[model samples]
Target: MNTLNLADGYKVDHRNQYPEGTELVYSNWTPRKSRIPGVDKVTFFGLQYFIKKYLQEDFDRNFFNKPKQEVVAEYRRRINAYLGPDAITFEHVEALHDLGYLPVEIKALPEGTRVPLRTAMFTIKNTLPQFFWVTNFLETILSCVIWMPCTSATISLEYRKILNQYAIETGGDMEFVPFQGHDFSFRGMAGLEAAMMSGAGHLLNFTGTDTIPAIDFLEEYYNADATKEMIGASVPATEHSVMCMGTELDEIETFKRLINETYPTGIVSIVSDTWDFWKVITEYVPQLKEQILVRDGKVVIRPDSGDPIKIICGDPEAEVGTPEYKGAVECLYETFGGTISETGYKLLDQHIGLIYGDSITLERCQQICENLKQKGFASTNVVFGIGSFTYQYVTRDTFGFAMKATYGEVNGQGREIFKDPKTDDGTKKSARGLLGIYKDANGNLEMKDRADYETEAGGELKTVYKDGQLLVEMSLAEIRDLQAQEVAMDLTQEESI
Candidate 1:
């Protein structure tokens, strides 16, 4: 497919729709509102990835690097067939191919910054007057590629906050927080690309992920090295099929083999609910207690079904003195006694732990942590497999994300453009004219729209890409450090409050 065809059908005709002598189209990408409660800000991420992958690599490979005539002919054939013969001229396509580079400038906030709702995260405009249509022409791809990573990163940050709060309150090791919220979302995502994007978003906040290609993506685009740093990691773990292969009757022997023979000196996870989950917890675990204790590593019990809160933290509605009532954490505690933390929370025995990955949510994660704390256990006693339910079940509207032209120039006269629909709520309302982003005295980001070009060029919204070249690139470590600073500031504010 021609890279130029990677847009809505209507976009091909948009070049001629602009007013006569229109020489510039300045647009900004903003999140108008947040549907997720307590997440008033969206994490700014993935712009460098988009610029590198699509604007530079894809265009060079699929469009610019090819013979000008070949690429132009391909674009013409596609457009004519899609929109009927000669719906639009191929002059712009030829012009772009002849230029051999994207003539646009993009300015953005630092990638890891948390941008408040209604504030623009980035702005784009054509650097060449004759190529003004290029800015919004790229809008379709920009919005499509950007929103998911931002949404996933924002949601992942919320999970980080929740887990961090619980870890502090429950006397858990702070170093273990990154490994607590593991990503199990790869298979559930929209496709391979979507999984990689959202999984990398998850990796921005956590180190444990089952999405293997997400690590590859970071190494490729974000300057991360798995050998030199902990980009993302996972332990040897079993699913239902691996357990079912041993048969439900021989499940105990399977656990014993995995612990003693398969993974003897490191963390191993086994799904415990292929048959009767409670029986495995109450009967099978105790029977193999000595084997587990004498082993040199942790055996993580994974319960994949039932109410996650109840499965890991006990059910108030179940019968007393049963495994269902005691829950996986308490049952493991009974089989292998553990110590209490300095803050008086129970730390599970080193040999055994628990993880629940099925349909987990932020509210459920909080409830599980709270229930465990109430039961006198550390929040770190169990890990969470954050799957597609959290990352896949979202859309661009998850944060009301949009890219709209706010300013334009026609006949050398600048126009302040905006839209506020009288027929509906203000989520569709857009910022007017050129925009500037600045930090307040308290270090919170604030927006100033309708500004002049000089003002828009100032503030924290620095130039990241210009004229087909990346101006500023952030490494994975730098992004993580920025996020940590933001999280620390947020926690400090919360403490003061």
Candidate 2:
């Protein structure tokens, strides 16, 4: 059930077989931009777990456990088939593995910090005297480990910002903002690791997730044991399969059973749109009002299809009674007759609520919240299910993330390496020499190039990975605290603006 089981299987076999005499390949990776104008920072996360799980455990268990001769023979067989004959040597790999540890060091900005664009988040250095190619050799695995969690964390943080803004404006309970944007991306992720990593990223901002693997990942890697602290949770909710099992004609009966028979207490969600969504909301809901009202829990009606903004906030121009009828949130408000909050926004009745789970984007989320605010309704009446479109629909290039060697040593000499392609614009230019990150006086992130790692003093960048051992550890609670601090900083900046 480990997320790295498959990737660890074959990743040790992937290595470049050229450019002999390479004694070192030092690299530093950064998010140059977020592919959005005026967006200049990313939440740094999950690198330590990557290093521990894949670099240490996976390689040690799969590749290092093999006999040296057998490992060398396999590498030769595989590499020679691709490159002529004797393109490279596996002696260094065997030697390092035989030494029982990875001769590499990774210095990184503390996980959960809001790292600035074009600033180096991590610097990779090969500590082995002769194995200069080791650091670059691990680029395949390192890049794979770095990008997704950071991207997902950044995206989830953006969602948190939007929800927090609306909560502040509409007088919704600020504490509820953490659960306002739930993670519904498990079934939509690329694979198990993608689901767990991205889901863990979502947990950086919220406490609501349906991704089971994420909880395990947090407990295994981030010190978030469910028995100790609140990592993430979700209410008992029905999918289309469960609703369809009762057949469309008996859909109302299915709802009745879900409320009365299966879960009569706490919170429960039923996919109301399995047959006729509006009919369930406008007709059957009122008919079952007695049962729903008397129950000790809230019934969250889910609308899975149609334009989310219009479906949740009501269509201004569309005719009533049509399939594109007035949305679920507005309908719930009409039937329940809610009280107004101190901010003059309508708060739905405690017994009923709404959640939209289909094709939700950050832009659409803003529109839905704004529409509700304009209609005198608090954003708390509804929750948004952030899925793959917000998590998996991204790549390393989404933030221009790349790991390039900037400093290296060869033949008793120290070299500062860099690349600035003449064929392209300045976006490809990379940093030179050793790098370090520090927080400025105003609590903003700043970067600096150092003569060497030893010369750096009291910087925010810490030694996270060294000699196949993890040096720093973070917990889910600590990460949430950092995010809360970032939110406070953002609020302060907005006030200044």
Candidate 3:
């Protein structure tokens, strides 16, 4: 027979937990793609597919319901044809199953920030350019690795800033500059890959996440945990006390009882004003202040309903020159009637903090900020937990993202070509030829034309795979850390308004 039956009785629980320090290494890599048969070459290709397959694990085929072996074989052939023949084999196949699709060398910005179009977040320099055809297959996976996380992260950063400004405009004094919290996006994520990406988004600016796998991935893949060393890091965590999604007198009592049981030491939060906000604030807040805020220490109060402008809304009747809400009032004490103190001081009123999760966004944040300006509450001590619209459903992220074949150089002549699509669906058009990179005075990236692929300045575009060998080696922690740094440094901010 085919001797393939020997692979039987192998209960490959591809889903089982791997041992802690187990590393899947492609040890014999050579940085050159072999000129092999049945291979294709193209610039900036397969980027979207790579992200979905490796990071997302999206393998749903209606084309056929064939055996798992057949599907896996095709994948192996494709990977080997492009990466290297020696890159993988039967002996190490099980390990490959363990690592998922590993994130290779990626150039990306941190999760929360702005990025410009037509620039490299990071580049994939194939270790094996000669194996041109095989190495080109990675274009999909490499591009997908970047696109969405960077996009969602950039947007979320602005959302929080706007909310903080709004709270200040409405007369709420900001206390903590960057508040500590967790990402509750588990219910909002599209899938495990999305969940993981969201977790990366959480780490960009916020403290931490509640997802255990996310935690494990962060540690195993990134090697950095906020709970321990980093003084400012937020190692996300939570407790399962019940909650009331409404505002009422009984609701306040219910919230109080839960607080009493869960955080007897005094640090916690309750979703106040489930029905009637001002009334609950007037009736319950003062009474529970001692036990909830003083007994152990201090707890944060969350107001999920009502316009943040009104709840922290200042009295317009107060003169601009008066304290607290006065436009000309310069000092915190002049405005709040008391100097800054820990329990009740200028800072408490001037430096107090909170989280606004109700329909918050960048534009909404800007509006809130304007409202606060009129109210005299200009403090940068709050955060916004963005949800649903942006973070939850991000599938178009095909990165639809593509790199063009800007210029192709034949034996001695070079030609510049652009795909003239019969019907342009966005991704249909692309630049023709070999790609090269250059750095400008500001250290930013610039792509230039190449008249000859046989001798281009940026070396060959292909890397990592060479002559049936893998040229470079990477660790998950290393890739994760690099991605983290790349995202953080992704600021293309303009100084003027």
Judge candidate 2 at residue 123 and give its lDDT: 79
Kindly list the per-residue Cα lDDT of model 3 for residues 248-278, writing each as its tens digit: 4366666566557655653455554355544
Cα lDDT tens digits, model 2, 1-497, are 22212334334433444244456667887887678545679999988788878887877776677666766677667667766588666666567657777788888877898888899888777787665656766776778877999999998998898899888889898887888889999988889998999999999999889998899999999888898788898999999999989999888898888899999898999888887888998899988888888889899999999889989988878886543555677778778877888888999888998888899988899899999998789999888999998898999988999888887666656678888999977788888877767777887778877456664436776778888788888888998899989987898789799
lDDT, candidate 1, 1-497, per-residue tens: 67898898889989899998999999999999988888899999999999999999999999999998898888888878888998889888889888989999999999988999999999999999999999999999999999999999999999999899989998998999999999999999999999999999999999999999999999999999999999999999998899989998899999989998999889999999999999998899999988889888899999999999899988888999878888889988988989988899999888888889999999999999999999999999989999999998899999999999999999999999999999868789898999989989988899999898788877888888999899999998998888888788889899999
RMSD of 2: 3.0
Q: Give lDDT per model, in order.
A: 0.92, 0.82, 0.40
The model with the greatest lDDT is 1
Those runs of model 2 whose alpha carbons end farther than 4 Å from true positions after fitting are: 1-24, 320-325, 450-458
TM-score of each: 0.99, 0.93, 0.58
- The candidates, ranked best first by TM-score, are 1, 2, 3
lDDT for 146 in candidate 3 is 45
Best by TM-score: 1
Q: Candidate 3, residue 427: CA error in Å? A: 8.6
